[model samples]
Target: MKVSCLIFFLFFSLFAVAQTTPTPKKKLVVVNSYTQYRAAIKSNPNNELVEIKKAIPGISLDIRYATKNNFMQQVMYKQARAFARKPVVESLKKIQKELNKKGYGLKIFDGYRPYAITVEFYKKASDKNFVANPAKGSKHNRGCAVDLTLINLKTGKELEMPTPYDSFSAAAAAKYEKVSPEAKKNRNFLISIMAKYRMNVLENEWWHYDFADWKNYDLMDIPFEKL
Candidate 1:
């Protein structure tokens, strides 16, 4: 019958459209399992998360998230530790050596953040521009980013920067020119030194740097204790 043929044609058309339309992608790959993390390092040594302190004994750590000093105003990390991928640590080692020769050294604030903590940051952050969206993950989650500043090697005092770490102010931008001359000089020096070691600065954060090969690592949710 003509009615039956029309229904069949409509069904065929609907099925063809469904088949052609792409399905939504799976949720972003977040390596949360300790077992999976171990597997990853086993497969590629580069994936190993190296503790910054152990690797560079001379490096200073403030670890704000481990105390109540960060923007969160609550302890987010159980331990005051910093970490990065093996190559990233190596680059820091070289940069530290270079800085030490200049009577300067690196002071770490944060590194190798867990993806879960990033999600927590996004949920409560008043300035979304400063926080990473959980939907895409963060370079810090991949152990390929670091938050740091320069320090006086002899006096052990932090160099004056454009703005304090985790400042929501516009002056936190790496290239912001309205800062004092001394602060601008220190900020530019830090940026240039970090760039020399393949650590590129984040546009809006004077102290944040991402390793050139960040894409090689997967977003990780494994905590500090496991690393």
Candidate 2:
């Protein structure tokens, strides 16, 4: 009887220890060195980050993170520039041409975010669903994601969207049905056009798109200044 109690106590102690022990975090490889980025470009020219505005003529930029108007309510980026991988930028250039023919233009909001900025976003973001977790990294950190909206080429006015950039509301969803007809039309048009060029919309974000080949690139911590 005493031996049985001892075994039971030992088993209970072992179970308690197992329950208290934290699971080990998965290791993430983030390329933080400028030289490493350069070497990557050398190995695969497609890995090069290309400035969107420079690659696409007449592209408009309203980098919200550069100003205090973003969801953060604080300036998150020093420069108001946008970038993407070589193929991604090439696709954007083609998309701009296609949009221009229809009297529309592309307005860039954010692109090629540094991994460090993603960590900051995860830390301060009130709604965890809207921000990328630093542990997994963001496609923006890989230069394979873009936040943009459509605009009238002639008047340079933004088309109506379901919700404003980074709204973090259910209405911000790409397929949300509660928005106005005009907003839904514009949102679907933007998604369709981007999709045609290998950029697919985030299900919860009307203005955000992820390049189909985003996994080809590594998460990078290289800042805009370094790039």
lDDT of 1: 0.96
Can you write out model 1's per-residue Cα lDDT over 1-227, one digit (the tens) per residue?
99999999999999999999999988799998999989998999999999999999999999999999889899999999999999999999999999999999999999999999999999999999999999999999999999999999999999999899999999999899999999999999999999999999999999999999999999999999887
Give Cα-based local distance difference scores for all models: 0.96, 0.94
Poorest 10 consecutive residues by lDDT, candidate 1 = 24-33
Q: For residues 104-178, what per-residue lDDT tens digits would candidate 2 score against the true structure? A: 999999999999999999999999999999989999999999999999988999999989888988999999999
Each candidate: how many clashes?
0, 0
TM-score of 2: 0.89
* Superposed Cα deviation of residue 48, candidate 2 (Å): 0.4
Error of 1 at 50 (Å): 0.3
